[model samples]
Target chain A: MKKVIVHVTLKEGVLDPQGQTIETSLHSLGFTEVEEVRTGKTIELLLDNHDNVEARVQDMCTKLLANPVIEDYRVNVEEAVQS
Target chain B: MKKVIVHVTLKEGVLDPQGQTIETSLHSLGFTEVEEVRTGKTIELLLDNHDNVEARVQDMCTKLLANPVIEDYRVNVEEAVQS
Candidate 1:
């Protein structure tokens, strides 16, 4: 099977309240060296073999997994591996 | 500054309803070759320079970003880069 890992993160100018909260909490916990914290999501897909897998997975990201207006996604494909 | 990428994925056998929903949606959208889909979170932390960064971030993951009993987290530390 083919496994694809997608990393989805918010755009540069977007406000990430959750991240900010985490930052403050981190400082409170004594790790005060934080500059910024951005939170995002990772999606792993196990697929039946297909042609043009990367392009197809990117299509899925563009269409459903990410919001193009506010987020950008990176795709990492783990070629067919023994499972 | 340093950037740490934390990938948090559910332990095997944990029920992932959101991932299941996404898999179904993908098939409906004409990409029916999917076998399984797992969803998780990625936390990007832009941190101030400090010693033992990886250990600190892993601590952050176990304490806040991930549920230790149900999730496994991987940490990637990007050494200070000119930014």
Candidate 2:
């Protein structure tokens, strides 16, 4: 099996209210050293071993996993370690 | 400066409805080889250079970034590359 990890993050310059809120909260909590925060999504997928897995996974990201207009995604494919 | 990446993921055995929905959607989209899916949060933080930054980041995770009861988090601290 192949393990695919897709990270979807907002494009730079996009307003991330959630991140801003987190930063404010952290400051209030005494973590004043924190300067900036950006939040994103991490999706982990297990797939059957197959050819062209990376390409297929990229297509998945383009079609559904990420919103291309405002967000960017990176896909990492690795050998699934059996438990 | 430090670039801290916190990855918060649901504990193993926890039900992930969002992941299930994504898996179903992928199948319908003809990505039939997909077997399982899990979703998580990725928080990226930029912090001022300071002593004990890793410990501070871990505290941030415990206090605000992650729910220890149902989620596990990993922190990666790297030197912030200047633009």
Docking class of 1: high
- Worst 10-residue stretch by lDDT in candidate 1 chain B? B74-83
How many clashes in candidate 1? Answer: 0
Q: Could you tell me every candidate's TM-score relative to the true structure?
A: 0.93, 0.96
Worst 10 residues of 2 chain A by lDDT: A74-83
Per-residue lDDT of A71 in model 1: 95
Indicate which candidate wins on DockQ: 2
Q: Which ten residues in a row have the lowest lDDT in candidate 1 chain A?
A: A74-83
What would you estimate as the lDDT of candidate 1?
Answer: 0.90
In the predicted model 2, the residue pairs found to clash are none
**Number of clashing pairs per prediction, in order:** 0, 0
TM-score of chain B of 1: 0.92
lDDT of 1 by residue, B5-78 (tens): 88889999999999999999999999998889999997889988888899889888877878999999999997
Q: DockQ for each of the predicted structures, in order?
A: 0.84, 0.91
